[model samples]
Target: MSTDHGDRPVTGVRLQKVLAGAGVASRRVIEQYIVEGRIRVNGAVVTELGTRIDPEHDLVDVDGTAVQLDAGKRYVMLNKPTGVVSSMKDERGRPDLRRFTREWPERLYNVGRLDADTSGLLLLTNDGDLAHVLAHPSFGVTKVYIAKVDGRVSPQTIAALTRGITLEDGPIAADKARLRDSSHGSSLVELTLHSGRNRIVRRMMAAVGHPVTELVRRQFGPLRLGTLPSGHARELGKIELGALLTLARRDSPAEATPGEAREKTRDHGQHDDQENG
Candidate 1:
């Protein structure tokens, strides 16, 4: 299981990370299992957090059950449907994403989560490293959503949302927002933001007096929901994968995209101009 260079384990990744990505358990739970003498990597019990294993070549088992790993990492886009939880298992007995993963014997976990009521564009992967970067708020991977709200969203309300609104948690705003459509007292609005705050979009809309009735994630970073049927999944293409990783490698959230740089600079320049005025 050790792919080494000159007797030093140089390839693969931390054992707990690999196990967690394989959907065996959470990293903390896996660490406890390691100490309890239940996890074996290539027939050797692993207790050290530093232990590395080639997920491609490592044979891992827990409590006599084989922990399967893919020969290569898998990345898939799921157009999650409302009412289905975005997890491998749902304790409440609701439908979960495990149905999609049943085709692949290897384990995979959701990159983040899509609240059961707010569906679309969920990433599922067995690559823990990629998952960590995309999910970490420091990377600021942008997510786009379409919301159907309870009232006609005015330009002033939209401006307030763009300028930022204070919710119960804190002030949060969309990087971009516009009314997509309005009909029968319901308004359709699109929002783009990088903050991963739980239910940020719904809360923001509500704060602006336009409570959202339905929400769907349209894009996650570089990946789009695009015609993918609800409750179905598709493997990410190489080009899409490259773009996603590029976003993940940003030095900081502010540097994620060229357009973002201009926006940040404008925010600073606007303040300076106001002071001079």
Candidate 2:
């Protein structure tokens, strides 16, 4: 059995570090607050860099408000509708995601992006660390999209997509691709990709024969679109969160240890069932 060290001396941590650890803001932003005299320690404004404090003992405040050291992070999935821009702001005064999230208590930003004409599952979070992880390409989070193409896609075009196609940016390949449905002249196809390039799905299809007339993301890693109504937002449940964390951890450069690998294997089976069901 491993021995636990119950009594350990506290270590001094940088004031900015503590604020960042609490998810208040990034370390650089905290420094800006310090330089702006917006940060205080023990009721005295501290404008000095390299200021250190013991989180358990120090009384820290920002802008005259006591800093809560343990703020719970939040993750939300929003079904973004067409016509709303994905960005935080637009000079043209077009509708944006903020209109939908203005009622939320926490400030959140979009994870990845969907074009203004596209619609589907979009992630919003106040947890910067988690957002950074999910947005990083190295994490290899798969985004599954259902694309409605302008024309029928032949088997040869699908094969080219799976084999990888050359675009103006570079060579790109879909992890998985299959025709969801084909009727009349238009076709619906599902494409899964790990890369988050700008307008990747549409460009990839266009590189072949079928240009996408419409696109909607159906899944992101373990999170599925589910029958959740369009233009609605919901928080991810604990089970879904756990599964996504596991998937993210697996895709991390820090390869899963044997124990983690086994856990992921079991979780993968359940995730597949849930996603397909």
Candidate 3:
């Protein structure tokens, strides 16, 4: 089977084969999905087993969940260590992502910036569209962080975080904030926010009179840092990739009108600040 590309006939891989290769399901199960009209290719229901798709260009989904068919695409989670910059390369002779990215053959880039002094759960990918959805200010992807800060944090301080506080740039607030521990002249705070502001967490803590001494991002969207050790990098598992793709699809540029997206930004607050991982 093939698809027409302009005046040329472009040969494509069988739909089931592509899905199976992506570990979506066994070939037999995929065939059943096709027969039941549970699969879609580029928004059109595909019930034909002979349907061939250009995996590179066609969007495939089953039961509204996106299926990534591009084998060349790589999704990596790196537990970046402090002092390493988020950039692929640094012009000022500083440590950068090359140490970890050199292991992959593809020219991967970090999805968003993580402060050189902060660390954890940085995503590196060659998929530009996925990066855009996850990293773009308009998407407001949720992030979770744990911070160790000066002084004891009380329930009031945690409450203040969610209540919103003024920053040098503007007003910001955490979606959720909690005191993990408060003792030994220091406190541990867990903050959840969709803001991508630079050093937002540290600033938020400082606003409550608890300046952060150490910070680490634990989650971004559906991806978690898990037990991955510091300075280590790993490829996302099949399930993880599927969840990430689903998230990307949900916030995809095509899914919202410009006005709607702008409204979402306003409702979620201005997350235009670059993420301080």
Candidate 4:
């Protein structure tokens, strides 16, 4: 048993059992990780196999990556189709996220937005702390987009995207850009960036004289939009959820403890920059 700050009794399961139950690994493997000091509760590494934790409250990390101990939390990936809005409800009567999310019992909200005209991977979740961290551009969760542009994109154009260009908002650069293919007066280009600026990819391509004709976000952080048909949504697999949690933990500042992170998320529920191209 563990006690809260007020000294109230709180029942907790053993650390190894919790990790094993979350599918991090088998109990024996978790024990090995605990023995090797590769696990942390809250922010401190715990090597004792007998340690117990309040699963609903305490944060756990394995090999420095956060683990989602709260099984009730839902992590969903929706390959949003063009013309559907990102909002759960659209007063304007436009098609919205509710179409895809209504099936879940928990009220899941999108971690970020994609322009109605754009389509790709969008994370919908009930985990507010993870959503806040992933949606905030300052945390540097990279997004990759494959774009079909109006003009043939050259190596110089790719170079320029990475070298940085001055958008109306400010100067920005793709962490990486490459021309995937070029033919018949149009080109396929892939760009990776961490920016959450509105219609950023379209603007960036237009800036380089190759306006985007079509765009699809192929990846968001560690999650990939792979073979899920357009407009379809699916619950994240355990491995996928693990990767997302790990990325969120990695991007969050070291000093921000789990309790502080949750409190901050609740205090500023609307703080995440949900908008993106």
lDDT of 2 by residue, 1-277 (tens): 0112346443577888889987668999999998999987866788876677866556676765555454465667888888877766656898877776776798767776777788998877665444555655456678899999988888888888999999998999999999888899999999988886778888898888788888888898889989878888988775666566455544555433334443433222112111110
Which lDDT values do the candidates have, in the order given? 0.73, 0.72, 0.82, 0.83
Pairs of residues at least 3 apart in sequence or in different chains that clash in candidate 4 = none
Each model's Cα RMSD: 15.7, 15.2, 5.9, 3.9
In terms of TM-score, how similar is model 4 to the real structure?
Answer: 0.87
Best by lDDT: 4
Clashes of each: 0, 0, 2, 0
Q: Which lDDT tens digits does candidate 1 get at residues 1-277?
A: 4433465536678888887886768999988997888987866787666677877656677765555456377778988889877667666798888888777766777777777788888888766555655554566678899999998989998888889888887778789999999889999999998887777887788878888899999998889999999888988875676566555543334423434433433122112111000
Worst 10 contiguous positions by lDDT, candidate 3: 264-273
Error of 3 at 4 (Å): 13
For candidate 2, the TM-score is: 0.66
Task: Write down the TM-score of every candidate.
Answer: 0.66, 0.66, 0.87, 0.87
Look at candidate 4 and tell me the lDDT of residue 127.
78
